[model samples]
Target: MRMPAAKKVKSLPPADVEAIFARFHEIEPEPKGELDYVNAFTLLVAVVLSAQATDAGVNKATKRLFQLAPSPAAMAALGVEGIEAEIKTIGLFRNKAKNVFALSQQLLERHGGEVPADRGSLEALPGVGRKTANVVLNIWFKQPTIAVDTHLFRVGNRTGLAVADNPLAVEQILLKVVPERFMLHAHHWLILHGRYICKARRPECWRCPIREWCRYEPKTPAPNGA
Candidate 1:
């Protein structure tokens, strides 16, 4: 796809971007992370289930799973078959069930059934990737880590905030550009913005707050044909 021209406007300097984030904080000061979970263990399970699935879908599945098996020991004992039965509605339920069981086993053997705060340890678990590790680290441990999912990557590139090919590169650029004060909440702000407003196929730019800062061209809706 041809890259759209970013609308020409006064560039947002680092300080201006920081101010935007501050305003974001004021607007949604305690913007909670989307994925639902009760604790670290449950959080890990929820994130694993979230892959290739919507947060609403994952939450629907986990709402029952957590009630029955909230802890690693409880989950491990529940076994893959039992977990699969509960999460069958979610996408890739079988594979996710296997990974969740394996992750619980690793937690028991290595970290005494507690989710490790370290990125390396978290990623070492079955089905846990860099994005998952970043989410766990940032949300559970309060570390400043950005998990660049599709929404984030698109927003970063579309807004000319941090363009890159892959999530890792986008994440690195975001770390470098976003102010430290905004680092923790930046991921949520961007993700929420992209999901609700700056959608993939047809962005709802009319109600977008940062429309002026966007770099994308053809801002107005195009004719259905041609």
Candidate 2:
């Protein structure tokens, strides 16, 4: 069976974009990432483990792992095998375990047991990519960066806030469109919105807070028996 091609997304006008984010800001002035972590190191570890996995899953595994090895030095001491045992429930546990152990060692040896604030330094860590680096930078260090995950990508394109082929392109477009005041919290708001309201299978347009500003056509109607 041939699948229909995705519709071309039209970019929202600047005023519409501003109004959409204004509503978001009004609803939640301070949005936060759902990942559970104690410090920068734990946050980095949690994000690394979150690849191809949900935040809830990562939190469940990291609960015991973080209890045992909260810091870089501590995680390094746990060794790859120990880390593997702790995070075995998550997908790609073995490789993620190696990355966790190796990154911990790198932090200790090169960064003096600190998660660096710089993008280059953060990306240099094992298993860390652009999204992970952006998360750590924005959440931990207060940088205004949008990490384009699956949810954000969908929401951005669907709402006409950003229309791009890849995550990097979406990130750049969002950076250009979102207002300065809302930039820091924009990432969190968009991700949460996409995850809950603008779902991939069936977006709940009826209850969507920004439905008026959205450019997506054929909005799904409310199910029977409201």
Best by TM-score: 2
Q: What residue pairs are clashing in model 2?
A: none
What is candidate 2's lDDT per residue for 30-94, written digit by digit as tens?
Answer: 98888999999999999999998999999999999999999999999999999999999999999
Give TM-scores for every candidate, taking all chains together and pairing residue i with residue i: 0.91, 0.97
- Encode model 1's per-residue lDDT on 1-226: one tens digit a residue: 1233333333346765676677678878777777789999999999989988999999999998999999999999999999999999999999999999999999999999899999999999999999999999989999999988888888888777777766777799889989987898899888898899898888877767777677666685644562
- lDDT for each of the candidates? 0.85, 0.92
State the local distance difference test value for candidate 1. 0.85
Stretch of 10 with least lDDT, candidate 1: 1-10
User: In terms of lDDT, which candidate is strongest?
Assistant: 2
Scanning candidate 2 in windows of ten residues, the lowest lDDT window is: 1-10
